[model samples]
Target: MTIFKRGEKELALIELKNITKCYKIGQIQVNALNGVDLSIENGEFVSIMGPSGSGKSTLLNVIGCLDQPTTGTYKLGDNNVEKVSDWQLSDIRNQFIGFVFQSFHLLPGLTALENVELPLIYRGILGKERKKRAIEALESLDLGDRMHHLPTQLSGGQQQRVAIARAIVGKPSVLLADEPTGALDSKSSVNIMSVFQKLNQEMGITIVQVTHEETIAQYGHKIFRLFDGKIEKIEVLNESLKAIE
Candidate 1:
């Protein structure tokens, strides 16, 4: 049997080796990422935290296949992302990754149900099946009653929930969230964190979130602190404890 199947050190779903990204700003060269090495296991919930210009968002984008590293290799479930074509990368991203952003990113004109169905449409799923899965996803997030509502009709939290439902409907292997609770109030933030915890624990979905809030980062199983484009520290939280109090 494969070591991965046996749950050994081999179950790495995302692996980064000496990853670097550099940007050229006129005559100046800015290094967004600098030889970062990391590994994320299947079904793990991890949070990335750092200050501005620390490359937290850059790392997230690299892991999500939204951007390519200038050097080094990124492997997602054994596929070398650095070698793949743009079309191939797009296919892989659509197949294995779901993304949640701070802005919600829902369509203004479409109803919540229709917005959730967009991913399915990209995968070529039919109308009936798409609607069915979309409804199921909305119900899972307790947004069943808001299915017919438009983005402007819902509250910020409700809109974010709709975005989350849309993200998970495709059943991707990893859910990449960038500042998911950035736009929410305290109560809504707690509710969203609870939902993320449930998804990570019950659904066995790998979650990688980037956030600047310490309170929000505490919800993750493991926390990686980034500084100046490199990882400075990592902390593992005890599952039994609610917070590191």
Candidate 2:
């Protein structure tokens, strides 16, 4: 697979053109996203910030191809994700997008390595190859020593790292994290942010994360501030806070 270099003339990995998402709850119509236009270039570390009902999660869902927009276009890589069938969207998500949630979401029954191997199992990877990749993924997050531990046995930050390992084990082109650090303490959050920075700067993975904490948002190169279901402003940081190594 070809990795996107920072200065190369690569197309936007995620492009949202006038995207909107509306949900009808009985008699009430809720607009989660309203004509939001956004673009995330390859190898970029971008953060989305907004208050409750601001459409941060909705936008992340649209970008991850997990949910379709009500109108407008969503281009993931070169594919128009909004036009794809549900099955095709699943394929695109499995092959191109990785997701991390606020809740660690690691299975209590499965060991860290086993949990990371789950995605590859769905892809029909063989046992030996799957094990190898899963170990590498865990190691990348400095979780090599805890690969055999269950989620309940690890710390909050360790569990989150395991979740991240699971997300990246598939070699997805983009990682969409929704409130990834919400459950961790300050030190743990910094550790996770450092891992994200290494992945973005060294491995060239495109990272789009939704964070409510301003300190956490400072880790990204750019911040998209959303309000009332639309992007109100974009702030480019002169210098992003370096993740603790």
Candidate 3:
């Protein structure tokens, strides 16, 4: 029941209450998440970090609406995501969540602009408008010159920029990035993180990123440390830094 100011209104972008996710493998039951409660305010940058098998990915899946919790409740804005039907869930995901993967999931045949336009096409936007917006998004990402290039012709960083252009073209409520720099080299990783930081600070986009790298996590305003299926600690680093006298 936490509220934050968003423009003229008070709103919460994401809310999770007593969330639990479990899996049954043959005779053994494994708990992936155990009664986790979290709330992310609008326009906040958050990072979830943990070791392998620490339920970090599970938590991200639940937050992204890609997977459901075994128990507890999740609300994205005012919508009860936990109760939504599969079709309805898909609709919510399409309209609300934008996801970026480590692998840069770009269509092989489509050019950069075309790949960025894919989500708009699925939403039934006309070709002209879609292309306009796609081009604008690419241009914003400094990929205007590369719009006609296929993914195979692009560098790793360029491909990822294309993926980011695709993610943002629809103006989704939350940007969920899982190890966005995992596949990039050190230089490319820095560039990608710089883009993320600029997006958060300048555009005020709500970004929730999951990463194992501490350097990457420092970019977030808040860090949630996960361990053994639970959130062990939550640190408000920006606030802490301000408090240091």
Candidate 4:
């Protein structure tokens, strides 16, 4: 449970300045994000909390490189997000951002190991090395024995673990999760949160998650509350729940 300290020691991994996102629908403009400014430091676990339609998901997309902002600047690592080409943006997403979603998003037909291996395969890694790394990622999440299980064969929490392993197999710099535990039961949600804590604290992977639940949001070092597409306030927590043993 450590709040992110400001000043020079904290290097910014995600920087947003006057970021805005708008969508046009039937002659009306919808503002999903309005002049939002944010900074997430390396190794920090931050949560964005808001009601539905508050732009949390849009903000997540901008941070994850899934979509570009309508205006303002976004800097991720050394790349200026607004200035990068689409191809470069694709590369950035592949190399720097790991995404976890509410839905497990596992392929029903693939085994856990195979699903985890997809990212490495997309990067064109050799088959043997890919298999090794995928197995290692699953083992890190204590899913080593479930490597051969299909999504249907696993429990909800186990399937989420598989999804997490898949997200992390490429060793991306930042993990972006949107309602990661929204679909899980209380016990499973806590398990997923613990897994996230371990990843952020031990593996040094920076995490930014969007959640509506207060209990889930407390897992992060800082919570950003959003209202009507604008950030209402940022609260630094005293401590995150200690990583589950």
What are the lDDT scores of the predictions, listed in order? 0.88, 0.90, 0.86, 0.89
Best candidate, TM-score-wise? Answer: 2
- The window of 10 residues in a row where model 2 has the poorest summed lDDT is 1-10
What's the TM-score of each model vs. the native? 0.94, 0.96, 0.93, 0.95
lDDT of 1: 0.88
CA-only RMSD, every prediction: 2.8, 1.8, 3.7, 3.7
TM-score sort, best first: 2, 4, 1, 3
Q: Per-residue lDDT of 1-245 in model 4, one digit per residue for the tens?
A: 12233222356878999999999999999999999999988888999998899999999999998999999998776557776788988888887789999998999999999999999987999999999999999999999999999999999999999999999998888899999998999999999999999898788888899999999888889999998988999999977465675
Q: Higher TM-score: candidate 2 or 3?
A: 2
Best by lDDT: 2
Candidate 3, superposed: residue stretches over 4 Å from native: 1-9, 239-245
Summarize candidate 1's per-residue lDDT along 1-245 as a digit string, tens digits: 01122123346988899999999999999999998888888878899999999999999999998899999998887668877788987887787789999999999999999999999999999999999999999999999999999999999999999999999999888899999999999989888888888787778788899999999988888898888888888898877525322
lDDT of 4: 0.89
Q: Where does candidate 4 clash, by residue pair? A: 1-240
Model 2: per-residue lDDT, tens digit, 1-245?
Answer: 23344444368877899999999999999999999999888888899999998999999998888899999998776667797789988888888788999998888899999999999999999999999999999998889999999998999999999999999999877899999999999999999999999888887788999999999889888999999999999999866457457
Q: For candidate 3, what is the lDDT?
A: 0.86
Superior by TM-score: candidate 2 or candidate 4? 2
lDDT of 2: 0.90
